[model samples]
Each structure stands twice: as structure tokens, then as C-alpha cells.
Target: MDHLTALENKSIFIIREAYFRFRNIAMLWSVGKDSTTLLWLVRKAFFGVVPFPVIHIDTTYKFPEMYRFRDEYAKKWGLNLIVGRNEGQVEAGMGPGKGTKLDCCNELKTNALKQIIEKNGFKALLLGIRRDEHGIRAKERVFSPRDENFKWDYENQPAELWDQYKSTAAEDNHFRVHPILHMTELDIWKYMKKENIPLTELYVSKNGKRYRSIGCAPCCSPIDSTASNVDEIIAELESTHTSERAGRAQDKEDAYTMQKLRSLGYM
Candidate 1:
């Protein structure tokens, strides 16, 4: 098989394994390239049908285009999309503008996700986090476990070699399956283009500016770029020196900001 086929096969196998092992599981869709790619993989895994619900934590500050794209695609594809939000915090006038990036992420994104997981009793979450995304993500396993408090134990991650992944975990520990951990950013865009996957328009250049990463609208900024299409984006990633997460404000506030937020159950 070619590289793309091999990646798809591995992801399909992992998704099936997670479905068979976990009683209650769901997939998290951030409406970004990675998660959207994973969403396509899920449909492929189950013969063009996704059995689990796709979760999206709406911070209420996301780019307007994100919601529009999300709703449009979800309906078009017949997706079981579950949107979660912390209405209480939003009503209390809480947002990124009121406090530090860490604090804002905690209230707007992390806490909202935790509540959704608990409310739905999801025993496993399939995330599209890749090892190449960052140093912290590099330490994650194909099937990592998190405690009831959503604390990721990086030191105690399970081992997987030659396609054998460990999917079982204790009662209070939830499994996190990373199907595309080994795929690079280039591989994702290639697969998306090859599969003709629908994506948000925000990634396309708008008046010489385009977002490299999508997050809370107030916190995520666009990088200076001229890439207007998938082909141009692929070329940009090949020559770009900036990190993929550089456009993310929370990541730049401190070296350990991601680790700290993730430790508190942030995705």
C-alpha cells in the first residue's frame, strides 16, 4: 500500500479497536484540519457511517465562520454533532479579555470540555493530537489514559508496536486514542485534498492574511501569508519556519502554558 493508504488503514484499525474496547466513547471535533481529517477517517472506518457523536466545545468566542461551517457540514453529512458551552461563565462576563490566556482557556475551553465528558459519560475520547504538533504532544501514546480528573500521566503511557495497541484501562481512567499521531502536517493536507474533505473557509487567505491555526476568535490570530488554496498551503508548510502553534496566543504566554492547561484537563 502507498503511504496514504497505510495511514488510513492504521487509523481504521485503531478506531475499530477503540469501538470494541470502550463501552462509551466519542470523538472530539475542533473543526480544524486535524479533527476534520479524523472525522473523515471515522466515516471511512465504519463504512461511510460514524457511530459515535462528535463533540465540539464552543467557547462563544470562536470565529463566526467556524460555527457556520460546522453547522453546514454537520447537517450535510448527517453528523451527530454535540456542541457544549459554559453558559454560566459567559453570562458572568468571563472571557479572554478579562484575564490571562491560561485563565481564559480554563474557563472557556477546558472546563466546558470536562463538563461535556462527564455529562455524556464518555469513557473514551478520540482526539486528533499528533506527536509532531508540539513537544508535549510528542510524549503521548497511541492509546493514552487519563484519570477521572482528566489528568494525563505522560510517564505511564502504554506501549504499542507493530499495530498492537492497548485499549483497556481502569474504571476511573479514560482512554485517549490518537490514530494519526505518526502522520505529519503535510500528510493531513494531502489526505484532505485527496479525499476532497470539506473545510472551513477561514484557512483561505483573506486580503493577504490567513489563520494558520483556529481557536477562540479573540485569542487566535492570523499569520501573514499569501496561500489561498490547498496547493499553496502545502507549499507554505514545506518552507515555513514558524511553528504551527505560533498563531495560538495561549501557547506563547509561557513555555509551560500548554502543559499546565492540559494538566487541568484541557485539550
Candidate 2:
């Protein structure tokens, strides 16, 4: 099989395995290129039917385009979409502009996810996280476990070799299943193009700027680029030396901000 085909096959296998192993599970959809591609793969894995709920941890600060794209696609695809939000925090005036980005993320994103997961009693969550995206994510396993507090102990991780994974954990522990951990930024774009996966046009350049990474509107900024099409984006990825998340503001708050964020259950 070709490289892309191999990746696709492995991801499908992982998705199937996660569904079979975890009786109650959900998938996180960030409405970004990677997660949308992942959602597409989930459909293919289950023969055009996703078997579980799709959750979006809404910070309520995302761009209007993102909200529109999410609502439109969620309806069009017939997804069992569940939007999670920390209404109390938002009412209490927690946001990117109010305090440190770390604090805001913890309040809006992490705690919001915690509420939904516990309320729904989800045993596992399929997240679209790639190892190459950031240094902290490189330490993640295909099935990483989190405690009741949603804290990850990165110091101890099980080994997986030759498609064998140790996904066993305490009954109360939550598993974060990463099917696309092996796909890089370039691989994702190529797969999106090959599969005709639809993404929000925010990634496409407008006025010589485009969002390389999509997140909360206040935390994410646009990059200087003119790559409006998928083909042009692939070419840019091949030639550019810039990091994919160079425009993300929360990541720059501290030297280990990403680590801290992920450790506390930030996606």
C-alpha cells in the first residue's frame, strides 16, 4: 500500500478498535482541518455511519465563520453533535482578554470538557491530535489515560509496538484515543485533498492572510500567506519552514504552556 493508504488503514483500524473496546465513547470535533478529516475517516471506518456522539467544547469565543461552518456541517452530515460550554465561567467573565490565557483555557475549555464527559459518563474520547503538531503532544500514546481529575501523568506511559496497544486502565479512568497521531500537518492536508474532505474557508488565504491553525478567535491569528487552494497549501507546506501553530497566542504564554495545557486536559 502507498504511504497515505497505509496511514488511512491504520487510522480506520484504530478507530474501530476504540469503538469496540470502549462501550461509551465520543469524538472531539474542533471544526478544523484535522478534526474534520478525522470525522470523515470515522464515517469511512463505520461504512458511512459514525456510531458515537461528536462533542465540541465551545469556548464561545470562536470566530463567526467557525460557528457557521460547525452548525452547517453538523446538520448536513447528520452528526449527533453535542456542544459543551462552561456557561458559569462565561457568565463569571472568564475569557482570553480577562486574565492569563492559561487560566482562561482551563476555565472555558478544560473544565467545560470535564463537565460534559462526567455528565455523559464517557469512558473514552477520540481526539484528532498528531505527534508532530507540538512538542508536548509528541509524548502522547494512541490510547492515553486520564484520571478522574482529567490530569495526565506523562511520566508513565505504556508501550505499543507493531500495532499492539495497551489501552487497559482503571474503570474510572478516561482514555483519550488518538487515531491520527501519526499524521503530520502535510499528511493531513494531502489526505483532505485526496478524500475531498470539507474544511472551513478560514484556512484558505484571504487578503494575504489565513489561519494556519484554528482555535478561539481571540487566541488565534492569521499568517501571511496567499495559498488559497489545497494544491497551493500543499506546495507551501513543502517549502515553508514555519511552525504550524506560530500564530497561536496561548502557546506562547510560557515555555511549557502546551505541556501544562495538555496535562490539565486541554485539547
Q: Could you say which candidate leads in TM-score?
A: 2
lDDT of 2 by residue, 1-267 (tens): 999999999999999999999879999999999999899999999998888999999999998999999999888889999999999999999998898888999999999999999899998999999999999999999999999998889999887878887778897899999999999999999999888899899999999999999999888889999999999999999999989998984455655887788999996
RMSDs, each prediction?
Answer: 5.7, 5.7
RMSD of 2: 5.7
Name the best candidate (by lDDT). Answer: 2
Model 2 pairs in collision? none
Ten-residue stretch with the least lDDT total in model 1: 249-258
Total clashes for model 2: 0
Model 2, residue 200: C-alpha shift (Å): 0.3
For model 1, which pairs clash?
none
Candidate 1: where are CA atoms >4 Å away? Answer: 249-267
Over 208-266, each residue of candidate 1 has an lDDT whose tens digit, in order, gives: 99998898888788989899999899999999988888888455566588678889998
